[model samples]
Each structure stands twice: as structure tokens, then as C-alpha cells.
Target: MPDWLSLYYEQPIELTHGEGRHVWDAEGNRYLDFFGGILTTMTAHALPEVTKAIGEQAGRILHTSTLYLSRPMVELAERIAGLSGIPDARVFFTTSGTEANDTALLLATQYRRSNQVLAMRNSYHGRSFSSVGITGNSAWSPTSLSPVQTLYVHGGVRGRGPYAHLGDAEYIAACVADLEDMLGQTAGGVAALIAEPVQGVGGFTMPPDGLYAAFREVLDRHGILWISDEVQTGWGRTGEHFWGWQAHAGNGPPDLLTFAKGIGNGMSVGGVVARAEVMNCLTAHSVSTFGGSPVTMTAALANLTHLLEHDLQGNARRVGGLLAERLRAVTAGLGLVREVRGRGLMIGVELVRPGTDEPSPEAAGLVLEAARERGLLIGRGGTGGVALRIAPPLSLTVAEAEEGAELLGQALHAAQDHMTGRRS
Candidate 1:
């Protein structure tokens, strides 16, 4: 592994296997998995339907390129097109979210004939060259050299920003005005605005409801395309809405939407859904050799079917709501907890120094270590790496939610005690 490849915990354990919301390490210690492999295991681990589909397809065939007409690929594309609200929608599958965002950028820049783009502050799109160009989080973005001249806009993070003190309506207006100012300063026409509905790597932070809707009005005026990067927030993870952009559904859907991470249930499935005109704008020959392989498509189709048939979206709404409430109650009196924010199952507990607003990555690290010692697996992320990110499978039960919350509470208290020099 590269030196930059970061691993969790002071002592990381290798996971051997997982069933539903629980995974066992090589040493045979079972843990309640709260992070869900960075929210990739959407429905559950080792879901029978998805496993069976993968096996059935693999037995038949696996590596038929896009040059061939694969039934599974076409079928999955049809399903996604219908799910995507863009008029005359088209779907193009990639192997990961990075490629999906790259394709979206390709389409947007090609259609608009401009390389200048707009992204949100404290946002994380992906690791690819093009995707990194639009990332606002400095930690993830390794270099300043970028193919696109990305001008970052604001309103992605609600509680921390220049307009954080403003009321909800005022905050929206200020962000919109800032966007207008950015547009005015642009030398030429900008290609698009790419943003995450809820920033995943940026500590799962999000704007108030309808913030994107307000920004959409501004983008529309300048004929700028809107790309909703739903890599983390897609497929009912947010609970309240199937797509995170629906929270800002003042206008219709975005011109393009990129998705990955959960749709394949850890099986490398990603794609971009766009209006026909935008998707068809590419005149040059292009194809993803392993993008929509029959095996992966079959897995995605089965996983998506299970998600819809079981009403996992509704489950996320109900169970995630309960989990969030439990977390808030547990962390209410903790001075190290800066804020507990997020929607549905994608929740973040940002840690700060005791009795101060300063972010405390050390406190977050302690909490993660404590949670692991107690046989609970969560995640940590933020601009300063000071937030605990909790997102279990959509099929997480109420009992599991209660158990995870209790474990997390104990972990929080332990970290607090350690930080205050009262280790026990």
C-alpha cells in the first residue's frame, strides 16, 4: 500500500466476514458495523438476493464488454433512467463514483464549451484528476494543478461558514448572492456546478433544506448545468428523500447526477444519469471496458430490486430517525461534542475541545479507538478530521440502532474521560 493510504484506529483489525449489520475480525471478535464500509453496504452484508444474482450471472457469463448488447446492462439502465427524474434521461455506468463524476464533467464541459466549473466549499467528490479539481476539501485534493478551473461556491456546510450566524432564509440568500458574484467574475461561460447533497468525506455536513433549490435558480439564469454528486447520499441513505436533491426540490432534478458506492452493495457499480441532450453531447468514441459488466449489472439490478421491494427508503427514514434522536440524547451534555448533525442514517458527531469551539481531531481519534475497543465500528471524517460518521445498513433494525447508540455513548464518555485526564 502507498504511504498515503490511511487506515483507521491506532490498531486496525482485518475484517474476515460480515452477515447483516455485524462483522467479525480475523481474531474472531464480532462488531456491530455502524459505518457500513463507508456507507457502501446499503441494504445489508451478504444479502442473499444480491449474492444469488451475482452467482447466477457469473455462472452464465461475466466479461462481455459494452460493445456487445447485454440484457442485464440494458435492463439496469432502463431501471435507473426511470428512477432519474431528468427529462429524457440516459444512464451510463462506470466502475466507481470517480469515473461517474469524470463522465459528468466530460458531458458538462463538452456541452457548454467551457472548462470553468463551480463546486461547493468543504466538499469531496472523488479522487480522480477531474473529480479532485472540483473538490473543496484541501486534505483530499493533493494538488493545485487541475484540468478544470474550478471556482468553489458556498452553502454546502450549514453550521460553519461566513454566513453560519444568519437565519436559514438569510443564509440561503447570502449563498445565492455569493454564487451570483462568482458568475459575474467568470471570464467566460462556466460549464456546471457539481455538489454533494450531503458532503460525505467532509463530515456528512449539509445545508438547510432548499439551499440547492435556491442555488438552482441562479445556475439556470446563467445556463450552467447542475450536477448532484449523490455518491454517498443516493439510494435512500438520507431517509427523508430517495435523492438528497429532493430536499431542495424547488426546481426539478439536476441536469446530471452521479451515483455509486451503495447501488452495487460493494460490487463496483457507478454511473451518470443525465438529460439525453447532455449525455449524447459526446461526439468522440467512448466506452467503459468494465463499466457495465454483466455480473456487476446483475448485482446492481438485484440489489436495487431488493432495496425498492423492501421499502428500504422508508426503513432508513424510520430507523435512522430513531438512531439520530438516540445519538442527540446521548451526546447532549458532552462538552467535547461540538454538534450532531446530518439526516437519516448519515449522521455526524463533530468533536471539539472541552469548553471550546476549536475542532479536536485527537478527541475524535480517541472516540474511534474507544468505539473499536467496545466492539463497535464507526468512521471519522471532516475538514479537520474531528467528526464521528455513523451510517449503518438501510436494513438496520431498531434494536441494532439502540445497541449501537449505547456503545457509541460509552465510547464518547470514555473519550471525554481520557481527554479530561480521568481515564478509568
Candidate 2:
């Protein structure tokens, strides 16, 4: 209706620009951007160092195909690998998170030579070929869920899940058992177990304790590839760690790690870090033209440097801790909220589902609309669309965080009052 582009949402606003944690409309009205471009721009809009890197790179060579090596690309790749801690890991950059995940999945397939993929019901890795097959977001996968799609999408390996949430230990255990059974049935044909270290779009939450370890144990025994989608949770957003997998590293490292979002400080840069074996499999597996461009690599390098210099990881931990606590208290005693989940800057408010664990999509929508109306920009993600995502820039101030939570609390209150009207 707004005529910017053909889109799916009911109402769309014309946002002009964003800085730090806020954006403005064409009318010059400012609004807080808590959504952070769906969690990709967590470093905030037009970050100085990142912008400088891009501008400087633009003056030089923009890109070169994967056939030739570039210094910045090599340097950034090494940095990514070092932070990743995946032995002898290598990087292959992409322009977006979807492409990164897609490529990672491709590498897994080649390495294991198997077709089966195990994913959570609410997981969202990407939308690219085969990746969509692995993505559990209903919106992106409903039509692709046919029996035929299931086979190819399942990649000739035994397919399973949209498993139970991370809140249930029994369900978590069962998911591991289920994978074991599927692997057993297929005679070890299961190629990979792909998951978000902290499910971002599935609602920013980590699985119960022993969850990752449980899966790791099984996958280890079965020699299954483990892929961690850190698209939305990486770059120190989760506070306790710079990477999501660290939240459960007691289990072991992932075979492959995919990162996007804040890696290049809102610039279009993404990459996958893989162990030596997995890296070898990919180099021998296939190739891409724009995988690693000089321009993007320079920006990524600058971004990483800024993150370290500013101790952004530490900031995220401090501010995010405050944000999470205020969030829990803001929604306290509110019947419309069921829970608040996630770590660091990645937070999710679970709307009341009444008698079930399933969130109330209607309430969530109302909160998004209300937040936007109240000079705050928030968004929803999750199978039920009942999770209000609050992933702001790591540079956000404590004041901004408090203001955001307070506004969201007001909006949630309004949401509860207008729920019936919205439904009608």
C-alpha cells in the first residue's frame, strides 16, 4: 500500500535513515530501531569505521573473483578463523547470510556425501536452494514442504524435525534420540545437524542445558557434520560469548560456522568458517564468483578491528545484561507475556499463549505496531510470530535500552487491551 515495493506486510512506513539505535521517516519523525534490520545491522547504521573502510575500498579495487587472492580477504578470513577456533578453518565470503548458509550446507553435502539434514522445527538458516529445505520457518518453507520437496530438500538423507523448544529437557533429549534413530535407520546416512547456536529468527533463545552436548555426542558417534548458523547471534550479541556456540561449547565445536549481520558492520558481507576437513571439502566441492570481494573484506577487517578496540563484546555483555533484566521486569505481572528469552543483545519477549506454549501472534503484531507508533521500531520472528525481537546495535547506550524496554512495555500493555479489536 505504501508503494515502495511489492511486499507482504499489512502496513509499511517510509524510513529515511538510521543512526545508532534510531531512524527517521520522510516526515522527519525519529523512531528507535530496535529490530536492527532484522538483526544484521547490530553495529548500527553508518558506523564510522565500517563506513570509512567501505569508502576507502571504493577508491581502490572493489572486488576480484575467487580465482585470485586478495590481501584484505585473506586477512579478514584469518581473523574470522582465529575467533572461530575451528582448526585450520578457512573463510569463503558471501553477500548475504542466506548465501553463506546455502554455501555451508553445500560444503556439508560434499563432505559427508549424504543427503539427510536434521533441523529444529522453528529454525531459520536461509532461503537459498537446499537451505530452504533446512529452514523451518513456516513462511519460507510451507509450499516447499511437499513430499517431493521433502526428498530433495531432505537431500536423500533421513529427514526429521521441527523439534520441541529448548525449554523442555525431555523434548531436547528426545530430539537427540530422534536423530540417533534416524541415523540408525539410514545406516549412518545422516549428513548434517544444522542449528542456530542461539535461534535468532526462531526467537532469540538457546536450548536447555545439555541440549547442545546431547546433539554433539550423537553427531560425534555418527560422524555427522554440525553446522552453526550464527547469522543473527554472532558478533558478540549474546553477551556471555562472542559466538553463540560458546554457550554450549562444553559439547564441542561445530564442524562449520556461518556468520553474517554485524561482521561487516551492516555492509553486505557474510562468510562461513570451517574446519580443515570441511574447508578442504568446500574448496574441492564448488566455487562462487562474488564469494570474497576485496571491498567487503576490507570492511569486515575494519569492523573486526573496531569491535576489538571498542571491546564491543564486553559492552554487549554489560548493556545486554541490563536490557534483559529490565525486560523481564517490564513484562512482569503482565498476563500477555509468557516469557523473555535469549542472551546479550538478542532478546525475545514471548507473548502469552493462553493455555499452550505456542505464542499469541495477534498480541505480538499489536506490540510491533504499537512500538512503531510510539517512536520505536520493533519486529517479530518465530513460528508463531509471537516473539518481539529486540536486537539493537552493540553500541547502544543503557539509556536507549531502558527507553526501548519502557516503550515496548507500554506498547505491550496497549496490545493486551486491543487484542480482541485487532482480531476482529
Best by lDDT: 1
Provide the lDDT at 151 for model 2. Answer: 20
The lDDT per prediction is: 0.94, 0.76
State the local distance difference test value for candidate 2: 0.76
Please give the clash total of every predicted structure, in order: 0, 5
Top candidate on TM-score is 1
Candidate 1 lDDT by residue in tens digits, 1-424: 8999999987779999999999999999999999989889999999999999999999999898899999999999999989878889999999999999999999999999999999999999899999998999998999999999999888989988799999999999999999999999989999999999999999999998999999989889899999999999999999999999999989999999999999999899999999999999989998889999999999999999999999999999999999999999999899899899998899999999887999999999999999999999999889889989999999999999999999999999999888888532
Backbone-clash count (model 2): 5
- For model 1, the stretches where C-alpha displacement exceeds 4 angstroms are 422-424
Model 2 TM-score? 0.89
TM-score of each: 0.99, 0.89
Which lDDT value does model 1 have at 410?
97
Tens digit of per-residue lDDT, candidate 2, span 167-283: 365656666666666666664467777888777777775666556767788778778888888898788888788888887686667899998878876678888889877777655
